[model samples]
Target: MKTGSLIAMLFPAFVMYAQPGKLVWEENFNSNKIDTSVWNFETGTGVNGDWGTGQLDRATDRKQNVAIKKGVKGADSSCLVITTRAEEFMDRKYTSGRINTKGKASWGPGHKIVARVYARDVKSMGQGFAFWMLPDEKPVGQKHMMWPQGGEIDIMEYVGSIPFHNLGSVHYAWSYENNEWQSWNHAHQGFYYSFKDQEVPNPSEPGYGNYPPAKNDTIAGSWGFHDYGINWYQDRIEFFVDSTVYHIHYLNDGATLNFAKDGENEDAIEEINGKRTGVSEYSNHFPEWHPYEHNMYIILSAGVGGSKNTYGGPISDAAKFPCSVFVDWVRVYEL
Candidate 1:
């Protein structure tokens, strides 16, 4: 494995904030070491497409990529450094940590879910990091359920190409006209929402055609240390970065229910009438809308060379050795 250096980002202070809720669990990273009591290590590569197919293969049973350390005096309380382990023939290399509270800190259906985190030392290009969650497991017969159906909520996702900005998205499934599972393609539908700096791509731009244009800036350096969080409830979900609300999603309801099915077809109508009962039902237990209601754990990792980067191609030759993602702490509250 190619040894890489890690850079740590320093923040000015340590602070915690909560609103009208009970504090259930938290990890401030102030112990100067990972608290094994709250987090369980996730070894090997992830079995999904979000972080690229093969990026996790480079992670081994080594502390070079993930670990806890004392904060630089006056800068941070404690820091978690994620470094990259280089590989031959592979133009890029990255390694990060993933910890989850699945059975340990799992939240039930009705409680609100929230996490407060500060991230920095992100690469200027060719890699990305995220703080998100997915269901711990699916019902036995429902193993076929994919992401949205299984449910995925992205509290904050930062692309290296646009490090200064973050994205918040919720994914779930919807029934289609074709009642049979084989014909579901024409009936499949979903929604995606993202927020970023003003310089980021705007899907609504006129004449932009199907593809959104890309823009770059030095702003990634300015995001040195910032707060990112999410407020998740049974009926709705909201995203925030540094306390600023960027996206709001009310669970799929009647007004927005039409898009839940594939296309306008007899099958679509029947599926809707059969599954959708009421606003509360649609918002709370509807599998198509809230497949992730059971319990979820958190994940944080870095990717080097994936589909998202353009200017730097798949890898950044200029990336200094030992790139790091400093996190102040992760706190979860119930609302």
Candidate 2:
């Protein structure tokens, strides 16, 4: 697995097919530096509490908040510049940039990813500029669990005030003895951080988890530069943007985890426990051990701040202050 310029992951099944856009893993920030073999810049803040965006901000190594630079034209070569300047230096006013591939490569179950972005201006409002995945942060049982109790893989979350909107979610911890939290979103072009945490616009319900919103989408424009993907398999997950197909994010529709209809899931178990509560309680909210069943890594960030569970409300003023988010390449395949 070693002996070349890349591709030496050895085990943990991170894929290795090699053809048909099958590069297994890539970064293409086109050399010049910031490669560390496959990325790692991720300083402080996370798990310090409030990455959900009460995000007053912090996470920097500062190359102006991480850079490879070549901007304004979008990925044909060098890209991966995450900026978010509004500084106050750690006491938190705004400082950004985060990178990952934790430990070095990780992926389990099938696996697929595509990056290439340009992201939006994010008009502020509790800013959340991301392209994510996390299950490799290590430490979780003797009590180091985190975020929806250690299970999240967003794929892309643009909320600079929801312009041209786009989101993809998958959180967990539906009640690990009441730590609560749950998810299953594909996001409506008007998600508003889960619509400011529900209890309003009711349509018989779906204002909370159990999948809804984004039935047939394509409208993903903001600052332009598209193409976002996710495949994952082993149960279900298939989302795309420039490659089409809007959303799927499942866990088995036949044996049942919440299939949308046909076999009936009571609107996905009454949006998770309204009364029926029984489908193994929705796979017991995943993350059963060892980084949610074997390796899983990759994170590219351009964050600013959000807390109260991201885009929770009130952050406007066009959010402008050097807010940027771009990345030209990040491949990963073999599913």
lDDT of each: 0.47, 0.54
TM-scores, all candidates, are: 0.66, 0.31
lDDT of 1 by residue, 282-302 (tens): 323243334535677777665
Which regions of candidate 2 fall more than 4 Å away from where they truly are? 1-62, 67-82, 85-98, 109-128, 134-158, 163-167, 170-248, 257-269, 274-296, 303-317, 323-335
- Each candidate's clash count: 7, 9
Off by over 4 Å in 1: 1-18, 48-57, 73-76, 87-94, 108-118, 140-146, 175-218, 255-289, 308-313
Candidate 1 lDDT score at position 291: 56
lDDT by residue (tens digit), candidate 2, 137-175: 545334344455556667677665454445665655433
